[model samples]
Target: MNSIRFTKWLFSTLLFISVAVSSCQKDDNVKSMDSNKSIAAADSASTMGVINTPGNFLAGKGTLKITIEDSTYTFDAATDSVAFINVHSGDSKYFGITAINKAHTMSFGISSVGFAATNVNSKVAGSQFLFKLDEKNPVVQYTLTKYGGKDDSGKISIEKYNNDNLIAKGTFFTFLAKDDKVNSPFYRVEGSFELQLK
Candidate 1:
């Protein structure tokens, strides 16, 4: 009888131990799941940083500040933006600034296949990345090449480009330009802006 009681007690103790262990394992799983959710929430909050917060740019020496409606084309225009790295329309890396009405499009580009982003120098006569401008009026195209006595020139700086935000800041000093349908002159196209990429 004593042996029987001992066996019964042992079985009860084992059952209790099993239940306690199972409960602990369940709690651990729940804690892990909660941690994962918190991490996901944090990641979502930092995506692309901010939007519509257009930065400020000061037109330097030779550039003219052209204003249209409410925004200035040279600075603080809602149309200014940065592009993804090597992820452009067909697989190109570019930075562009445009007029609010989408009438003017100025872009800088470099072929990323065998080029380093750090080597993009507009000041160099034969820069790896070239500057090109396209405007309405049946969309006249202008390049940074030299004209009568002026040449397009500038510099680009990537302040911070990451999962959080992208910033391609720079200054430009271009000149009187001529194309098939456009004859435009620039005193200097110098400005610097900081904002996230679209």
Candidate 2:
């Protein structure tokens, strides 16, 4: 009876040890899988010009899309370019963004002051929108100016801004008047842009 009891105790001990070892291995596997997932997420964000951490900026090509009246124009990183320029003269600072098509005949531009990450979802001050078509012959142009009459109104809302990266994503809607006149013919313009400042 004593020997039998001893054997039973030994068997129970072995069983307990086996389960503990297996549980530890399973937990290790779960930890490893979590680590791999984190790495994958970081890689994905970097590819899209997004940084998960604060104060880090990633530079990447951007896209722009604008619709004038019923005609839509799309410009991508390929065969086109988006430029963001910071102009500073005297005590004034201006932010300018331009998107040009591959053919170089069509372009859209914006100029604003006090446009920054802090101004997200707010209309920028001194904002102006300009659209140019057929740059070669006479340059057909439309504009939305800040102080224009009620008919010539527009707003630019910054949806996303990464100050460290100087990357801005925004949406704009405007009634662009020919020759910047309130009584002139106008076209409804709507667009979105993602730009990396130079």
Candidate 3:
């Protein structure tokens, strides 16, 4: 009878030990799941960074126009004909200006006119990607290459003053792009604009 009691007590102790170990395993699993959830939340929050808003600007469409003078023409070996030398100013309606990293990107079109030819109704769509502007002077340089010709580039210097009650503005610049067969037969163009933001 003493041996039988000892055996029963031993069996009971073993069952209690098993139950304790299982409980500890379940608690560890719960803690692991909670830790994983916290890590996921922290990663999601860190991925969203700060975003800055740009200031309001005017629509430059139909707000400015440019005209060229002293365009020259020549013959080309590629076309095998006297292809009239010309420059196409893109349509202003499709032009755009945007601010990027303290600088401005001025993308616009030029109307190309053939030298010594009747006025044509077609204008080429061209763009300049990067234009550097100083916050103080805000002078911008525009450059673009002829579709199948040489590189044409120029500069524009703009000055402005901002006050609480009044604002003063000034702009003056010239840009030229030309297609040359031998020495670059091209045209010179200029733009002028005056605006008052109230």
Residue runs of model 2 more than 4 Å from their true location after superposition: 1-60, 122-138, 145-148, 163-166, 196-198
Worst window of 10 by summed lDDT in candidate 2? 19-28
Encode model 2's per-residue lDDT on 96-153: one tens digit a residue: 4555554555665554544456455533322223345444657666655433555345
lDDT of the candidates, in the order given: 0.30, 0.50, 0.27
Better of 2 and 3 by lDDT: 2
Per model, state how many residue pairs clash: 4, 0, 13
- Say what the RMSD of model 1 is: 26.4
The local distance difference test score of model 2 is: 0.50
Flag regions of model 1 displaced more than 4 Å.
1-142, 148-152, 176-186
Over 1-198, each residue of candidate 1 has an lDDT whose tens digit, in order, gives 653353234333323322222222222133344553343335432133211113311111112133222333442323222222221223422333322211223332221122223335434221111223433344333333344243334444433333233444433333323332234552333344443422
Give the candidate number with the greatest TM-score: 2
Better of 2 and 3 by TM-score: 2
> What shift in Å separates residue 107 of candidate 2 from its native position after superposition?
1.4
